[model samples]
Target: MTDRFRELVVNDSLVDIQYKTDPPTETVSPRVTYDRDDVPHVYCMKKTIPLSAFMERYARGEQRMWLAAYRPSNGRQTTITFAKHDRLTFGKRFIDAVAAERAHLFAPAQDSDGDASAPPPISSKKTAEVSSKAAKKISLEELELSLALQREIGRLGEDAAYRHEYVRLHALDCPNPAEHIVRISEDDVGAGYDMRSTFAGQTRYIEVKASTTRMDSFYISENERDTLAKVGQEAFIYLCRVDRDAPKNSAVVREIRDPMNPESGILLEAVAYKAKLSN
Candidate 1:
């Protein structure tokens, strides 16, 4: 990362910086500013720091931080924040943060005018209101149909990713492509992975996920987390994003390699668990 700040001050805490890929206009670096807040001070570092460097710094007890990629021309900023929990499971948290940020960044463009091709965007208030009313108004049949459609979309995404991996492996001259790229999801539902393959003489266990619309967050099962813990660097993730209205082939795959470690900057939240009843 290029140091843009001239008068750099090293604080005990780290700041949340914005990584811009574009070239800087001013050759002279700006002075670093310090804030008095107890929480990690916010400083939008305008330099492009390598993800590895950031991970190293974060792991060395530097600070829990957030990174935002800024595209000035488009006025779009994609942010990745790693908290205390994230630092504990760095790999998964970091990948998730970047994936979410990229998802928003790569979201399909909206129509400038009032066009019928896409639905209008909804505000937070409007969305909440609609969600509350949807449960009361939606019939049981409609709910089931909606759920079924969602499942189908997810299935399509997984299939698209599997096909992508197969083609990629075949192109790489991996022997017995069909047998090599096995869909573990079909064979063992509790395996915590969707597929397995050999890449660069190492076995890769992959977990496939799909998102119909742009999303910064997705679900991960406990089994998947356990698999990640057990496999470590051998685990991989393939995120397939497809537009529900577009052709299935139009899906885009984002590959995450060896996404498990304390240095990965992933935050783990306790959302669900099993409980036993006492007599």
Candidate 2:
């Protein structure tokens, strides 16, 4: 049976959506222009966006939805906006109705092109990123193992980076550099910092993140978050962006200081929590 698509109309605007089977949940910005018939029949909405972008926008904010589409005659694609609450309600109803009818498709697309003012739609131009918290199945052991491996890799990168920094300081002949440069990752005693180092008499705490891919995003533990808040300028995140296949000492180190500030635009997503039974 063919899968059905869902549709909703809002403020003279029509929004239509369906799920794609793509595994990578990254938003693919619309690249090519689609003809009027190719676009969805929603009020001036285009059908060029991937399912990932929809979910990404939903992740950032559930109150609204964004769509990529443009007028039929107009060539430029535009972002169409709508209230998600109302539209999603209609969508659930549509799905239930189709299911009641034992329809092969859950929410089939409608041929009704929206109001005349609505234009033919174009695909999305932005790629949206998926968050790890999104519902996906995995065994508890697998999850723990994956996390442990990631942490171990990160620690390796962090240790390498710290040693590199230490060597640089020693080369500079800084006063008792060995006394100042210390690895603190061994204990919670150092708080959220992974390594403590001094340069020109000032002490700085460093947190490290190691990634095989370019760091478009990274995880920040609650300890790191709180440490940033408390220490302010003294705290730094040393991003060890490594090309694993490359020879040794080839990782690019980028430092982000005071990342917890509101202007940083860093999103803190809670992936795990400790449960406490109520008394």
Identify the leading candidate in terms of TM-score.
1
Name the candidate that leads on lDDT.
1
User: How well is each residue in 1-279 modelled by candidate 2, as lDDT tens digits?
Assistant: 112222333322332232221233222221232234443223223444433233333332234344554443444444444332222212233323333432321223455674333222213332233357552333232233345446546766776677667776888887666777778877664478788888786777888888866788887778778987788877777878654334265453777777888766667888778999999
Tell me which residue pairs clash in candidate 1. 86-266, 86-267, 90-264, 90-265, 90-266, 91-264, 93-266
Q: Every model's Cα RMSD, please?
A: 20.6, 18.3
Model 1 per-residue lDDT at 53: 44
- What's the CA error at residue 109 for candidate 2, in Å? 28
List where candidate 1 sits over 4 angstroms from the true fold: 1-138
| Candidate 2 Cα errors over 4 Å, as ranges | 1-141, 167-172, 243-247, 250-252, 269-279
How does each model score on TM-score? Answer: 0.47, 0.45
lDDT of 2: 0.51
TM-score of 1: 0.47
